[model samples]
Target: MIPLLFALATTVAGPATPVDPTIARFDRCAALAKADPAKAAAEADAWRLGGGGLPARMCLGLAYAAQERFGPAAVAFEQAAREAEIQRDGRAATLWVQAGNAALADGDAGKARGFLDRALALPVLSSAQRGEAFLDHARAQVAVGYLDAARTDIDQALALVPRDPMAWLLSATLARRQSEGPRAAKDIAEAARLAPDEAAIAYEEGNVASLLGKPEEARAAWARAAGRDADSPAGRAAAMALAGKADAPPAP
Candidate 1:
């Protein structure tokens, strides 16, 4: 699930402004973003034109993200981050992370790396937030083939949030990339334990099983993933594996 940045209680950094009643409207738009992205985006756009400011643009960005229009969402979020910076708001780091996440989703690793670098340079992030930032930055690094740097970032993330399934999954994936079979198997096992129902975890377990020379275990794990959600990428990959196609690397 996407982090709810707007709902945080951190004090805004600029001169105090009276709470705008329109904030409720933007919140409503955001609340409906996934369920009705087109409507939410339209509402947010209209509000932005009427001088709704940062929150309105953020709502629009979320709406676009819900529709998987990640490139446009990154643009909106980057704009909001710049605006927040000019106002000296503490929300700048969160906005930068959102932009980075959108860019990553859009498969623009360079932009994601730049935005995440900005977020990490900010001093306002809480411990948990910093962990997430590191994990995301690591994802960007992995995309750009910086495996060593990704390992360092993910190590920091795991230090901060040891039980995070995503972080474990990423760790396992990176271990696999580095040809650390024992570590990959161990980490993927932890990820699977943490998120038993996650198709991606099952798929990764299969990968680790294959690497460990347990073909039967790999087939079983892959079959489990394929049965769980046939339309998902993990499911498709599992199916491909079952069809004698060469196994590919698991997605993060």
Candidate 2:
């Protein structure tokens, strides 16, 4: 969410003849949201009362997100998005994307789905931004057990952002879940190539290799995952998986 907000802020043009005071404040507030979320949230509230408009609301959302208070973050982002829409601001779609991400983080996949779809429905997003929205929508679909819907959205994301390792990783995971072993293998291979050192990708590579009946490859991948970060969830899971299967006979 910080990355998204920063990206948006970087693209805003400054005021006439000099720097835009509001934009500068927004930028400073974004930094504060990362460095001091509680203070940022308090200042953002005061800024909003002083008519700081979309930027103030967005900073408020960012502050909440930084604190992992995702429900309030989603509410703030949604309000900003709605106001942006009313103003016909081109940034409205991106704000909606932020709201959707916050909703997803808060474990409200249904709400996330609607918000992400709203972003996708808008034509204001760049190709990369649209791809991101689709990818997030796919995640929301997955959270709600709509695997088929997720597959469609993920495919769209890949079409637009084929270079994104995360997209390939999700595609591979989805393929594996659907029992499409060959597709899973292909997707996971790409994901591994793109993000060779990522423990999560390596862990998924192990899963895909196992599905493809390549126990040796699975073990090797899992070993790499565990070696990469023994404390991480993926690394720990990979270590456990490798231990469970290291001496087992190959699947028939």
List clashing residue pairs in candidate 1. none
Which residue pairs in model 2 clash with each other? none
lDDT of every predicted structure (CA atoms):
0.86, 0.86
Residues 14-113, model 1: lDDT tens digits: 7686555666576688888867999989988998899988888898899999898999899989988888999898889999999999999999999999
TM-scores of all models? 0.89, 0.90
Cand. 1 Cα-lDDT: 0.86
Q: Weakest 10 consecutive residues, lDDT, candidate 1?
A: 1-10
